[model samples]
Target: MLFPVLALIPATRTEPSSLLKLLAGEFAAQVAATWPEPHAAFLAAPAARRHLTCLALALGRDLPPIAERLLGGRLRHAIRLVLDPAPSGLERLLGRLGELAWDAEDYRTLLRLLAQRAPAKVLRHAQQVEPGAVRRLAGLPEPMGEAVGLALELTAEGVLVLREAYDALRLRDGPEAADVAASGWARAGSGKALFEAVRDDLTPEPLAPPHAGTTHLRPLRSKAELREAARRYRNCLGDRLSDAATGWQAFYEWEGPPGAIIGIQRDPIFGWRLEEARVGGNGAVPEAAREAIVSELALMGVHVGRSGWRLERLLRDDVGRGYRYWPPSQDVAEAFGDED
Candidate 1:
């Protein structure tokens, strides 16, 4: 009986890295308390590999749980964000806000904003908001069924306009208009140059150059460039500022003739892949341009695949519809028939 009891006992698991806990600093408890066990264990597993980026994120003290699940729970892509440096908008926002304002709801809202629309706008508005802005700006219960339904429900820029409008209204329409603006975000309107001057946030940005050769991808570095591409290409790409700004989706212009815009997207399931290739008025790419784009992206380790298995779905009377995307090539890059 004693021998059997001794055999029944299992060995204890080893603790995670001591460095991870130590570097967690004042936020160690919050980190230990908040992140799920697997993520915590994952964080701890890389004791020797812990570099500045990991340390930076650990100190950030407020990022998403479950979601930072970058690239199959591997730190390779996640750290490359810090290494090669693309705009990881959430981290930048949290760093701006500091630890005190790091609420989970705010994190979720910012994440939603970064993932969906107006990431640059979100970053700008958050930065400019008055002290205690983080607490103030986060719309509770997250307004239903709206993109950027922020601050009495408006885009980040729209919120600023509302604030400006309310300030003007308060003086003209008495304290009522002013009161809301003072307490929180607000709105007002002017009739026929009632206020002649409000400078827009627009700033000059360098334009993407025409490609010397077949064409290569160039990043849309500013709101000006994005608007210009939208105007020049006449594509349905004007609204993706947040997606690009946050590195969830990125917009690039093919630097040559006929003017095409390229969109590269990173998804949990589909790491980095060419999401769209559009010319003027959302037109399809010419074969030469498309092939060139595909070839270049392949060099960068991006897949330029299109609907192969998905097309097979209709043939077999499958139950699911493939998500719509601008097909890169007339020829299927690879056949991965959609599984219903």
Candidate 2:
């Protein structure tokens, strides 16, 4: 157990080279003493060879001749382990590598490690610190393009847009626009021209005249309608709501009223539900009634916020729920009589 655990620590140290050598010797002694022959054989086995090679590399010393001899028949397994280690082991190896002077192979190895692990910050640092090395590694004849491309694709939508533009304008009508668009497209693709064209065309058409019999409805129309529409729209998003809901819930949970239950109320005309929570500052409704209201609103896909407040206010005043009064205490019924 101790040998396995101690094997994890990289042999490189902050001390002088001599001290590292001493430390490595001590570690080796511990392994020899504490680990049985079977355990040593297992470590030297084809399946475990890479871990051992990594251990030797990290130690900055050649493995014992005996260990090397054991590895001869397990070259493939050793190669695989060196190629991929446990996360902790990989991290340790990287940290050890960082101490060495730059080498092309070392840079390539680091690039491969980053591509596999998606260590974005480390990769960025590596790119910045050794740009030429990164470029060389990128140009290497390897499947590294897949990893590099994936990273770019994940974070560079702007680059994609540029590529699309270049593709779109590769051939076009007018020489001037075509020239400009073609240059831009070469930078990305012809899609850029098409994108620009679509954007220009999509500029809002003059509002069509309302039909003679049609009564004008405002874009969102009323606050109630807006709130309901937002709610319904959000519900259609389903699991997509998890992120939005989490953010909203966290905000309201801390800043909004205590004991406030959120809810929704649908607009009868638009079939949209107004959703919101009942807070203490507002007139008191029974806990059950508030919950019921909020639940109905949520089921109708309403979330509580500014729009919710507007809807709630509208419901209370326009629907006559606002003027309705409840006794604060059942025991003192007359004390709160006629309260709005």
- Per-residue alpha-carbon lDDT of candidate 1 for residues 82-148, written as tens digits (9 for 90 to 100): 3345345543443354323233344444444455444346564564322233333443212211222
Candidate no. 1 TM-score: 0.33
lDDT of 1: 0.47
lDDT string, candidate 2, 1-340, tens digits? 8999999986643332332223233343423332333334434334234334434454444445435442565444444444444333333343333322343344445545455443434454442333333443343222223334333332245444434443444333434554453333233223344344433322222222111111111222222332344354343222222223222211111012233322222333324333333334433444444444444344434432334334455556435554543322331221112142
Query: How much is the lDDT of residue 126 in candidate 2?
Result: 44
Worst 10 residues of 2 by lDDT: 209-218
RMSD of each: 24.4, 18.6
- On lDDT, the candidate that comes out on top is 1
C-alpha TM-scores of all predictions: 0.33, 0.21
